[model samples]
Target chain A: MESSEAGLRPPRHRVSPRARAYWAVRASAGWLMPVAAQVIWLAADTARLGPHVAGLVLTAVVAAAHVTVMPQWRYRVHRWEATPEAVYTQSGWFNQERRIAPVSRIQTVDSERGPLEQVFRLANVTVTTASAAGPLKIHGLDRDTAQRLVDELTEGTSADRSDAT
Target chain B: MTERTEWRRLSGRMLVIHPIQELLRAWPVLIGLVFAGTAGGQSSWWSLGGAIAVIAAGMLRWFTTTYRVSAEQVQVRRGLLRRRLLTVPRDRIRTVDVTANLLHRSLGLAKVEVGTGRTDRKDDAVKLDALHVDEATRLRAELLHRTPARRETAREETATPSEVLLAAVPAAWVRYGPFTLTGLVTVGVIAGVAGRAVNEAHLDPGRLGPVSTLLERWEHAGLPAEIAALVAVLVVAVAIASTLGYVLAFYGFRLTRNTLGTLHVTRGLITTRSITIEERRLHGVEISEPLLLRAVRGARCLAITTGLRVGRGAERGGSLLLPPAPRAEAVRVGALVLGPTTPLTAPLTGHGRRAARRRYTRAVGLAALVVAALLVLSWTAGSPAWIWRLSLVLLPVAAFLAWDRARSLGHALIEATLVSRRGTLVRRRSALACEGVIGWNLRRSFFQRRAGLATLVATTAAGRQRIDVQDVPLGEALRLADEALPGLLTPFLDSADS
Candidate 1:
């Protein structure tokens, strides 16, 4: 772990290793939607394109690329750190974005574990503020880690609120 | 304080004025029905019955509504069957505005609207449709001044008279009207009215006698000449309408600041308006200069105050501390509104050459994308190649704009205030108190990272919520956050040795 003195640029922390499997499941679900539509079109006689072989091939290639390549790339790019002062998140691949939410500004911290995430023991933490830019989402953390982060954030914010007024 | 339990009705004049206003609103529908009935050869009795029903409903509504003001809250009870008792706490009240249209003014009545900070709910405001002018003014003062005894004591201690900040004369309208987009807005309004009139008339050009003859005369003149004439007429009409609108809206405009820490703005020629905003609630000031207004060295000043959640239209009409005036005058008023020591015209620190390059790249890329889209469209539609060739001229213009935008982006930390200036077409300079900043947001995209730049947004509870200093160096952004609010970011700073 990097020293805490890094200020707003906290040391990069990766999500749980099972995040790759979780992403694969999500990617397959997304790919199946278009593949299913293409299958319906191929079976339907009234389809305008009339069973496009090129389109089918392109779709398969795109889906295969997403399932195989995207998860690893995402894992490399996704980094988050929760300190006493702020929550830092660095995400995205092509247009990588780093965001910092000061602890004092945080209104609520919520941890949600979905059914798919339950299998992998993963959870996502959302930090909400009054900002119009919407909530700050920290995805793919271990369930226990997410819970501890939430508790830490809540405690920090509550301490700030008493002194702020 | 004596316990008052009686629920008082609005001024009796509302019974007459409300029904008349309701009838006026139904005029369009009544006219449409009349036309429809005449065309179908139906009786006029149906239209007459509809008018009576509308008037009866209006009267019933006026009779049923009643309001009461207690020490703790103001309650308005309305509706006979489905009664709604809206209770607004006395302390929660933020603004009190009184407005009077021609009819209301003639009847010595004004509409009093009490507003709280909550804007998400439509019914959060308490509106008394009609009240005696004197009573409205008194109520406005009472609601705005929460503690009357304290205000009186404070006023007596200061003993300072109200100072006039700005008063618009007829000549000021002529000087500022053309600089604003009011002419464009007037043109849009004229077009809408004309379109609606044409639809209602349904005049067939082929069967029309006078209109066809005029069309023939126009045809005798070439189509090009006819189009030119139409365009010239529209321009003249819009200019005249805009000037008239400016004169009508701000003929008797006045802005005054009192010792009681309240600002009173009274304006309008036909429909008079009185808006009161407390100085304590004011967060800061913003000086805005649109592209056209900037050309004329004109600017407008607005107050960034909390708990003044007037609707968009009302905000434009009321929140203006300084209307389209000289840049110097706007700055002067802005400084005055902010307080004695805070100067808005201080030199701001410019973001560096890397920011300029980033802006230029983004601007040129966007222009190129547009040109490419045009070329593709022309190729697919079999249009002339010159269509896209003409768009290639946008590159130089885009470069100039990007350079201008980069130069304009600046931020300054002046004592306890943070001033940020941005925008190419509508330049805005906002000065916010550092104490008001509740949080800080730091963002850096991939391009920004390569350029060593990031955007620092200061989140506050006042106007716009977030004020961003875009494309500043990453280190500078971190330094700004730390300086603006100490101890908040220091804990996370990396050790120097790292």
Candidate 2:
């Protein structure tokens, strides 16, 4: 929510609950090639240790872990906050990184909703700076929330030219 | 101002100098030609004729090339068939470097190169080869002179002609040379050349009977002893080569603060170079202490300035303010280069104990991975067990280094300058002006989050874009980002909510 308090820090908000489903879909899409290879290996009878059985077990374990465990853990760690001054994001599951892009330093703010995300009414926001450390990405936010954040950040950046000094 | 319209030709002596430069550049080709002639059973006169033809073409080019300086721009017009006219705006000119190789020096001529800060292009610099030394210097001064408006403001400062800041003597070479890898590099270069020459000459090892016999005699001393003797010889050779190379490169190294608020560095034994850099363009100074150099308290200082990009095949020594000097002297030079107000000796605020723990874990993890890889290799590739054993022994050393590296990591915001120090093997201490910083980046890994740590980075336009303050608490990173650029982060601070 937009707060009237000028100096008050913004509260960290988690991404949309549909983020888990989005992540699951993305992970499964990525595993397509590996799943296909495992299937071929089992069908070809090239496996040594009851190969089909082992491959099926491994695939199930990985699919289950990605669909059930990873997305939830990722959702818990993902947090972002935007005020008039700067945008802060805490992201990543394995190497949780916190990134801050001051409104004045932001070069661009982009919000995108993919076909899958649109189906779930989810969007992603990317705040880019001239920094080599790369852009700050806030993933799986509600579509409207992502739009508002982009508008606020872009407006803040446009209003402040003094930071260039 | 009226004199600027005149188009000028390089000194007539360029006919001689240009041809020599061309010949030098094509020497490898000429060498290859001679070998080809020998192989083809052709006359030596054929090679000589080819070399002469190349030199004549170079001389013709010298005669055709011409340049002019206009009020607002400098223009170079050359090429007979495909005439190229390159015009550079006067205001965009960043540096004027005058270089003279042995032949040019002997002929009292110098090659003037004007850089415009567009380092990405190889032909970004406009070069006037074989100009009279005095003419080159005058041209350099005329081109680099500040505009009248800025001159009026700097009048008080320009009252002094030029002040000598630091000068390198013969003793400096000895003091700094061995600590650098210059010797090892020289050895490698020499080996490469010698190997190539031997291959080209089709030399036979068996023909050197005495040398082979001497090697055979040494082989009886046992492999370990023989290896020790070889290493000892290599070290001695490398030491001699490094010192010689250092002396040759920086025989008369001198740094001067000129009247135009610019730094003038002139150095070299044979070729000699004069590099001029405007003081305003300087972003900061980087003091680097390599692992070996750190042991002897020696360090090098480089100007982290815009426009002076360290380009490949270009003279990178332009940014070098101080070569190998004692750490104290290097820091003093760094302060002097930055201006009298900046003190490099001030205490730095270090990241707390969590930083050390993180570093230790990272180091141990890395060592463990290496050990694991070696173990796997020993099992699969049937490698020796001793390799893994040696890696296991290095774990403690790795831990110690990590702790040292963590201790070295520090950041301090003093006035308008932010000083950050990092590294263990090659420690670098950089002082960047707060105003120069364009953005801030805060990063945290899962392990870092568990330890309540974050890495903060400040991005600038000059030198390395990102300077990091690693493993500080997340809260501190937020505060630092705010403090470094006031009002930039304050509007976003969710202090009450957090």
Task: Highest lDDT: give the candidate number.
Answer: 2
DockQ of each: 0.36, 0.31
TM-score of chain B of 1: 0.89
In model 2, which runs have C-alpha deviations exceeding 4 angstroms? A1-49, A52-93, A96-165, B2-19, B26-36, B41-92, B114-118, B121-131, B148-160, B166-173, B310-315, B340-342, B379-381, B496-498
Which candidate ranks first by TM-score, i.e. highest?
1
Worst 10 residues of 1 chain B by lDDT: B309-318
Stretches off by above 4 angstroms in model 1 are A1-7, A11-28, A45-51, A64-135, A139-165, B3-8, B41-57, B77-85, B148-170, B204-214, B217-231, B309-317, B340-343, B496-498
When summed lDDT is taken over every stretch of 10 residues in candidate 2 chain B, the lowest stretch is B489-498
Candidate 1, residues A84-130, lDDT tens digits: the string is 77777777665666666677777778999999999999999988765
Candidate 1, DockQ score (0 to 1): 0.36
**How much lDDT does each candidate structure score?**
0.76, 0.78
Two-chain complex of model 2, DockQ on C-alpha atoms against the true structure: 0.31
Clash counts for all predictions: 7, 10
Best by DockQ: 1
lDDT of 2 by residue, B62-151 (tens): 777889987678899888788888898888777788999899999999999887664436665688886999999989887887565577
Could you give the TM-score of chain B for each candidate, in order?
A: 0.89, 0.89
Whole-model alpha-carbon lDDT for candidate 1: 0.76
